[model samples]
Target: MPAFVLLIAALALAFLLSRLLRLLAQFRRIQRIPVSTVALLPGSGQAAVTGNASGAQLSSPFAAIPCVFWSIEVQEYRSNGRSGSWRTVLARTSDAPLVLDDGTGRVQIEPAGAALFLQDRFAAQQGMFGGLNQSTLDALERLGVRTRTWLSTSRRLRIRERQIRHGERVFALGEIARAGAQAALASTPDAPLLLSNRDAPALARDLTMRMLGLLALPLLLLLAALLIGVFG
Candidate 1:
């Protein structure tokens, strides 16, 4: 019975440790972003449609919007003698069809999606899990949220760039075009990217929290085992 208890405790400890590590990582990631920005991303379809309605309608008639789609693009720079070519990253279903420039024969990506994709692509490419310890990996596995792949693929573009103007801050068209090519790919279906203009930080935070929960499994089990020991 004591041996059995130890086995149970070990399993529990493994689970909890995994959860805690995942949450901590997520928290640290979220803390890096500005909260105000996440607020600006579009909400649920119903909320988006009714945002301009009467004040009474705006109170609490609808469910909160959950993240649906989020993507990032990145550019890679390589040298081919004196000339260079730019490739689009983060292709999605929603993005405009790519067209070859007649004069330059270069591929062009819509600016907005391109920028967002690049930020995420760069982040992923840099290896977010480079220094993660074994405990963290165990936690991620427990949560079933491991990074499967992050490569570029030839697919329809899903994110389109939209220009936003705010006073003197002018994002030039050519400026955004500099980010090389989008190469980082994401996991699908079970791990669909959560999209929200302002919620990246929140999403990162939630991921961290969820990881922590997984890590705590061991502690919870240990408590249960202690109780069983006293009772048995």
Candidate 2:
């Protein structure tokens, strides 16, 4: 009995340790990107109307608003035609600006211009197809080439071609947070950083839970082994 209890405690401890290690790894692996501003948009009325018939408020008013401290991964790939480099930055929220790393500096691309750039760049580069889904592709196509044309004339569309490996995470913040973070940036910072979100506590908690679950896997296996030994 004592051995069994000891084993249980050991399993729990192992699980916790595993979870901690995984969380640490994820934290170290995530790459954060900073932006100058963030904007919020109204949630789609159409989605809400179609989503629920109970009038249960298909979407929260805050759903459309962009929050600070969000993240995405930026991937750069060579154009199929070899005309120019193409970049794909994935975000959970579409209301925010695109991130740009210009070697010497980083900037938040205006949403309109960014959309245009993506549209034109994608269209020009053999339909701009990569990891995008049908919905995303449709959205990009609908966005058209007007804004990108304007941006090309104004800003140098020179993006340094770089590879972003799979599973790399990038972080972004709202305009206010970006401004604050920019002011706080020192010369030769170690890792990329973005503005901290006021609501980050919830996200942190969620991430912690995920890490804990990952840690529990080993414990579960051990328990299964113990149960089989006892029953058999």
**How do the predictions measure up, each by TM-score?**
0.29, 0.27
Q: Which portions of model 2 miss their true places by more than 4 Å?
A: 1-22, 25-198
Q: Which pairs of residues collide in candidate 2?
A: 37-175, 38-175
Q: Tens digit of lDDT per residue, candidate 2, span 26-124? A: 343232321222222122110000000011112111112222212222234434664755455422222333343323334332222111101011211
Cα RMSD for candidates in order: 20.6, 18.6
CA lDDT, every model vs. true structure: 0.32, 0.32
Q: Which ten residues in a row have the lowest lDDT in candidate 2?
A: 46-55
Off by over 4 Å in 1: 1-12, 33-198, 208-212
**Lowest lDDT block of 10, candidate 1:** 46-55
What is the alpha-carbon lDDT of model 1 when measured against the actual structure? Answer: 0.32
Candidate 1 vs. true structure, TM-score: 0.29
